[model samples]
Target: MPQLTQTEMFLAVLVAIFALPYAVWRLGRTDYYAPLVVVQIVGGILLGPGVLGAALPQLHATLFTPDVIAMLNGIAMWAVMLFVFVAGLELDLKAAWRWRGETGTTAALAFTTPMALGALVAGALLLLDARGEWVGAEGQDWQFVAGVGMACAVTALPILVLFLEKLAILRQPLGQRVLRYASLDDLAIWGVLALILLDWERVGRQAAFIALFVPAVWAMRAAMVRLAERDRWYVALVWVALLGLAADWSGLHFMVGAFLAGAVLDGEWFGTERVDRFRDTVLLALMPVFFLSTGLKTQWSAGGWAVAMFALALLVASVGGKLGGVALAGRLLKWPRGEARLIGWLLQTKALILIIFANVLLDKQVITPATFTALLLCAVASTMLTIPFATPALRQLDTHRA
Candidate 1:
């Protein structure tokens, strides 16, 4: 293996750290949340082995390493946590409680229907395309199937919030309902993923440990919230550090701990404004580094027919399952027809959360390089499709209500 010279490494870091923020800042002027992903992807490609290697081959080798990859994963997890915490902060717990009846039904339908459909679709794809007979640890069959199912059933609540805010609809009745549903959707999907991970014999014990660790950390957070309420900054620091440590100790990713900490402190220790400030700083600073890291790690050449089939299965299951389930639930619950269809479509958009979960599966070796790349492509495509499909419906509804 070749090592990068000191100069090359320093330049790579400088490009990752500086270039992303400048791009984000410029993008923020037009659409505060829209351009970060695009910019980071472009930045990564520019700094990555593909482009950089073609230009300055030496710098490329130095920047790619196990250590650097791990750092990128950590940063990605943190970015995800910050994003999820922001989502939690935006949740109207009160409204969620009020709509508990409808919300519960919608959530159950949304999670179960998509998950089951995704699993079935994935299984069929594996049978058709996969080489091996048994699809397990050796074959990577179960992992691919589960990954597709998860991608299909998942929703990025944070992205949904960003969309709502961009449209200036956060406080509207329909927006409020969508927000609450998205929150419930996230909780349900994550819980299901945790359960699925636990079912894996190799990592079952570790998953069990993390599951048990949640409440224990919640107890600690309960104490920290009381103490931090007195001195906000001190408490925030302590909370963040403790959360990161707990997640590490529990054999779970740090972002899980960060999100749980945020949830525990939500509405109690940190107010919306302060949380917003912290998020903006983190987004502007560390989040871009994380996305660039993912972009840097992604290799399109790894993809094959098997991966292509898996990605297609995920894309279809996610859209069809979520849309069909939500639509059915809406009619069954007697929601307005248009409103029901819109909700279904909106909930199908997958972005940050899908990427985060795909990384997790990748780390666990549950997804191959090719499969992971395909899933990322699927997420980007689905998110792009979402805006065009949902925007008109949302606008029409707004006009009707007015």
Candidate 2:
């Protein structure tokens, strides 16, 4: 392959880096968050070997590679960590504390029902050999089931946060409830994923290490928080380095450490505005590379009946499971029937977190390329469907608030 001129390389990098953020800022002006995901996908296809080269015939292959792809993953994961940390910082711990019982119960119902359903559906698909024969090194049918289950059960934290912010519900009771419950939901799903990864006999030591490391890290963090109250940035830099090293050493991804560190920092220690400012700077600088990397890793050719079926199954499980579970809890809790149903529908949006976890499973070989593609399609579709589906429900909530 011929190498690109320096000019070409520079232009390509510039476009790849700035395109998503520009689109996001523009979309924000119009009050649409759903289009950002579509923009990323479309941008990738356009800049990829498929469209740009076909149209221009002068673009080089230097823009795409495995190493660049890996770097993108690291950046994206860091962005996710910053995003989640900002979320944790935004949590009004006092309010969440008061609603702990309700939030815990609601989140439990919301998560467990979907997970069980996703796993069962995955098992059925595997048993029937729907997505290939599951003949890869990750075992036969059950392993596939667990992998699919984990994917289906995930909720998109970033998307959820964006939606709440857009809907002006972030400071409201319902929004606060959803955020707290969703945080719990994220924690639960991560735990379940860790367990599934271990059960599948992939990275057993890593899983064990995370399980042991989290509390110990938190305890240490608490102590550090007390001492560093006088010098916030000092504490931030130290914790960031410590967590990153610990994650690398434990064989877990550095993003995991970043996230844990952010979660520990919360707003209690650093104040919400300061944390948000730092998060924005990090996200603006590093997060687009992550999304671009995801686009680069996506395989458009991984399509067939099995992939289609799995995609359909993902849609069903994500929607049916979350909606059904939350609806049940809402009724049991004596929330108005309509409000309960709205909660079910609003929780359906899946975003960057789903994609991140999918990438992890793909890297671990827990899921095949075909399965990964299917899940990606599900993530895209679920995210798009969410805004339209939840609009009426959200409008109702708004009216109630008014």
Candidate 3:
């Protein structure tokens, strides 16, 4: 038998990366519950060490050789950076501010409530485990708890956008309201991440990065405004890359920089239609590999059952806390009975953002692989619940209106 060359092997891995998810998502018709992105994510896990590697160690090792893994990681890094940057750009802060009173009340409660519940659960795990399997080697107890809590609190803005569009409410008043709330929370989530990633030794560098970033944003915005729309797209890619480099150099991580780069620029410059196409293109072309790379990180070393239970616990905290908070906000704000229920279920969508958050935590060694796996599961489950649960609420609201 002739052995394949390195390039040949890399191509094979790519085939597996793209094929499996499409097959499952299309043939199984999982899109009603799980979007293609979600299926890709689950497929990635299936291809990763815990399942495929365990089942066929030799094939896994041979297919994902060191060079191929490196190549895949490279693609995943850029793909996610692009995804995060688009997410930041899509944030309509103006709309959020316009409705600040209601949006603030809803966003604040929606975020803080789940955070607290998730933190409590994390602390409980610490008490029960005794071996500290959940916390990362470089993490403090507080960081671990805070990271987990934030994971629960996050609403994946990009995923929420997808869901809204799917439900045919993307342009409606209710969809706009939900987007405003998610936008504010999206900003808060990144701020909390910066805090979690703070290193005392690198505090000065981080401060300098923030200081420099203001002028950088000013320059980027000025340049973007003057350029032709065609030119702006190319320039934006350069901007994302530079900020990613700067952010990583400052010990804050490239995704942080990528997001900051997009956050400062007005999405209007790109045109909504173009932005939508660009985001969809990135997802279709690049993010499958990112999902695959994410799957490769899954570990069940602490025992599969333990991880499964932890995921379930986190899921309850995420779902229940989100609904509870929104329900309270509805009562306080005098929202119609079912309005908050609809919003709560809509905001419960969490996939891309939560996975990215957990990935950062794992990268920073603030959480163990087992903990990351649990959070990943919680994210997938939460996102899957969004469409199923929200559809009913939407119909009920429509009925009431009728």
Best by TM-score: 3
lDDT of 2 at 185: 77
lDDT of each: 0.66, 0.66, 0.93
Summarize candidate 3's per-residue lDDT along 205-315 as a digit string, tens digits: 889998999898888888888999999999999999999999988888899999988899999999999999989999999999998899999999989999999999999
Off by over 4 Å in 3: 129-131
Q: Estimate the Cα RMSD of every predicted model relative to the unseen true structure.
A: 4.3, 4.0, 0.9
Query: What lDDT is reached at residue 25 by model 1?
Result: 52
Per-residue lDDT of candidate 2, residues 284-389 (tens digit): 6765666666555545444456667778888899888988889888877888646776677667777666777776676657676666667777877777777676
What ranges in model 1 sit over 4 Å off? 1-8, 11-13, 16-34, 38-59, 62-81, 84-94, 129-143, 199-218, 221-225, 228-233, 240-244, 301-309
> Model 2, stretches more than 4 Å misplaced?
1-11, 20-38, 45-60, 65-74, 84-97, 130-143, 199-219, 227-231, 301-306, 398-402
Candidate 2 worst ten-residue window by lDDT: 131-140
TM-score of each: 0.81, 0.82, 0.99
Question: Which residue pairs show collisions in model 3?
Answer: none
Per-residue CA lDDT of model 1 for 137-211, tens digit only, reads 433566567666777888877667666766677778877888788778777666655554444444664665567
* Model 1 TM-score on a 0 to 1 scale: 0.81
